[model samples]
Target chain A: MKIAVLIAPAVHPVSGRPCAGEADLAALALAQRLSSQVDVWYAGAADDAALADYLARGATHIHTLALAAGREVLSPLAEALQDYALVLCGARAGGGDGSGLLPYQLAEQLGRALLPDVLDLSKSDQQWQALQALPKGVRRTLAAKLPLVASVHARAASAVGWSYARLQQGKIQRKAATGAALPQVVLEPARRARALVAASKVSGHARMQGAIAGGEGKSAGIVVKQGDSVEKAQVVLDYLRQHQLVDF
Target chain B: MDFSTQAIPRIDPRRPWVLGPSGLKRIVLGDDSGSRDAALLAHGPAHKPLRSSGPFSQRLLVVAHAERGQLDDAAREAIAAAAILAGKDGEVLALLYGMQDAAPEALAELAVDRALTVADPGYAPEQKLALLQQLLQQESPHTVLFADRSEDADLGRRLACRARLSVVTDVVEIAADGVRRRQPGAGFSLRERAQVLLLARGVAEAKLPFVGKGERLQTAALPAISEQVQDLGSAASPASQLALEEADLIVSAGNGVSNVPGFLALAEALGAAVGASRVAVDDGRFSRDKQVGATGKTVQASAYIALGISGAVQHLQGIKSCRHVIAVNLDAAAPMIKRADLSIIDDCQSFISAFEALVRRERNLV
Candidate 1:
């Protein structure tokens, strides 16, 4: 089976230095585990120093579709990734637009099944199965036939460390590609976001009560230092019941 | 003493006089601060007057799924943003992906003029996307809003990409001219509002000065498509197997907990993820990934139960976002006791067994 891992240029959040995103590196690591016939593909400017990090993580060859400024990557990526049986990418980008739409777009354009936020992958009975992560520590398994795309969750695997030896052994092949012009975007310093609050429609007394009682009209916390184990447990249960965290 | 002699009146005319129910009490009458309360008492809780009566000129769309019979927080924010943007001349339309179980008054309170619901079971992204595209083509709304959540995010990106339309996602602020979002590396990005927008949480106030029409619209059935994907049902990972950062409820241990198995069993009974303080991790009783502190994984669980854990500053910092903290310790003067909403001074082992027994009894598992 052939596997392709998609990577993009990432910079450190604080220092603005080149570094591989944790998510993308996990994708590479997962791809390497699936099959040894794995290749790393990048669709951006070829000047990124972070490309070497991918090599150290175990990709022997890096294929770059060198896109100059003002070209969208969807079309070029969709075209270049058509033949591969399995394609892997990060659930979301660590930097840049970070919309995490490339994998979905490519899957849609190539007419392939897309499984996102995949934490583990394995092949059996000529089909690929994945363990997908959900919110609140829940997980769901999904299965689909060959020729699919998956976005790797950050927790999928621990990223491989940087090695100078592997960097020397890897190869980079760059090919200039062109597509649509970039959309107009302007970057600026961030401002505070406005929170959406439902307008209060209570009496002044009710409002005061809410304020004094710490909202939701619940009583303040209580300390139970003088209770036995059963009584203490009962108090805890009552608190949980009041908060609606547990129901019986 | 000249008691019979008439004395001059000692009343001062400049003094402020307050009239009470009776002359004996000093209570003041007609207080302006309580006027609102009085009015509410007379008329009950009145809804805000409608922004517009009818005959809307334009329309904005909000797409989301009803979670547990109501729109979740992120979706409500998006709806509110759309409502604000619609103004008096425009109308806000909500497109829901699940059953129309949200209360009508709640929808009206958010200024949702129209609601269209499509009820389909399971994971059907393709059909949902197609329905959305069809609606977009038909309505031609001024702007479509979506919450940047798990399902909506996927649907929004798919729709935008399929149509090749420029989209703005994770919008933190919205103005008449453009939207703003925190950029990838640092700073923020401001871009002209696109036809489709994915709003970040807490961007708009869902409360409005007026109620919406809150009328329901009928939805067309989705066309059947061939199924190539198989969903293999969801499962809850064991508490010990789950990562601390993603756990909603966590049971953590510290230096005070000696019975690790008892702690684990209690966590399992509560169906909570397990975590450990740095000291416990260093002691090799728990692995490094289960550690919760500044050097460890900072958690944002809804409820954190600390067993025999003295709250260190770093540990407190890690649990700053937790809504509820319950501590079981031997010392009432411990820092953990001070930070916890509920504190119990007891032996960790005894408390663990007692809590577990209560949980099992309450759940009727015994």
Candidate 2:
């Protein structure tokens, strides 16, 4: 059975090198574990000299869909992923427009059943049984036939580190996407942190209003009045509910 | 203006989700006796009838699902946002699902007049999507609002796609013309049409000026969906301290907690488990399991003594559940000190020693 894993570019925290996202890498590992015939696909620019990180992990075949700019990846990826028996993606992007909307949108575009936040996946009686998570760590068992989408949760499986020798031998195949007719949009840079605002003069009421609107005040608890250390400790202990938290 | 002012989508009741189970099924959630009025009185009789014509004809539907019959924080937030956006003309209606007990009275206490319920629990995602689609088409609502939850966002996108309507997900603000969110790219922020919006939490949190005269409307019949998905049940999430979530008193340390051995002793003296801030956890001073912060674990301790922790906002979020925070840090201006009930400015080692001595003396006296 052919299963495909989708990957997005993520910058390594310390080294600041481009690599696949952690959860996405977990999906790749899961796909590789499920079967040997795993096709790794990415939908953005691949400019790095060593794009072999995915190859080093477990991707035997890597397909990079080259999208220059302005085009929605939804269409290009949907066209590229039509043949696979199963599709796997990280539940959501960890960062960079992390709206967590793409997996579901992609599922809709592909016309397949989507089982998101999948904790574990296994084949049983010719059907794929998925362990799905709901709000607050609730787990549900869902089964579906082949030709469906399953997103990998962060805890799906531990990722195996990449090997140097494998990185050298892994091959990545690039595919040029058929561009759409829509007018190209100008690419924008990432938003930087909010610009620092200069301190402004304010009157009494306005200053009070700013404090309330800015929400700088704590809503609960009283400040401990300055006093002797022992008395302060008593106040602290009084605040601590012994039945709830303190053993004494 | 992009809000649904056009034609309503078509609906077929025979959709794979609406049909009731063909076989006997266990009641997954909700109390049948309390819901005795729920099935029949879902559309409250005392409430004014919803308009199907004129400028005010369009209905405002706020969709929320409850766990154990109480709406989650996000759901309540969405309800508030929807109510605020509805203004005075449109009838604010709530589509509540997954009640495990009697029909909730909370919504009725809000400004909502009518509530549609599907007290059935454990329905599959596909079944939920289908039922919502039927309801949307049936109501032909002018505006629809849902919470920005994982399931709700997925279902909203799918429903939008099927109905050929525009959907705005993760909307932080709703205006007359468009909705706004964080800048998707650089230079300027992005906006979306206001037809269907999935509200992000923490924005709208006000109760209706008056309580909703809410009544339980009969939920649509839910047929069993694809059995491919099963509930494996829930397990407790792993936390830093085994008892951190249950602990009512916590003695936490941060980067300033240099003396690990002494700190542990002091915590033991206070009968408190050790919790570390993100700084300490990141510095390798404490294991990830002992980290206390938003990304790690949010403790609900009654008394949280934070030592040497210059509380970051993320750390503060983790300790928001903490009832009483006692901050001990050298920096008086640290954000944590402002939030703490007891703010002590002193050297970390000296303060811990003095506090420990005081605690020991108090114990000896006892």
- For each predicted model, how many residue pairs clash, with residues at least 3 apart or on different chains? 2, 25
Candidates 1 onward: DockQ, in order: 0.49, 0.17
Off by over 4 Å in 1: A194-248, B1-53, B109-111, B118-120, B205-213, B218-223, B252-263, B275-351, B361-366
The docking quality of candidate 1, as DockQ, is 0.49
- lDDT (10s digit) by residue, model 1, range B1-366: 776697755544333334233312132333322222233333344436775676778889998876445565678778878877786688888888775566677668767888887775456777777777788888789888899877788778878877777788888888656888877876788888888898887788754546788777876576576556788887767555667888878999999999999998888888888999999999999999898989999887767999999999999999976778999999888889878889899999899999999999998888
Candidate maximizing DockQ: 1
- lDDT per residue as tens, model 2, A1-248: 88889877665656656666777888888888888888888776555343567777766667888877545577888888999979999876543445566677777788787778787889899788888766433467777787888888866776678787777777778888854643322333433322212123333543454345443235343555466555555655655543233434
lDDT of 2 by residue, B73-159 (tens): 577777766656665566678777765344445555554657877765563666776777777777877777788885666566656
Scoring only the A-chain of each prediction against the true A-chain gives TM-scores of: 0.86, 0.70
When candidate 2 is compared with the true two-chain complex, its DockQ is: 0.17
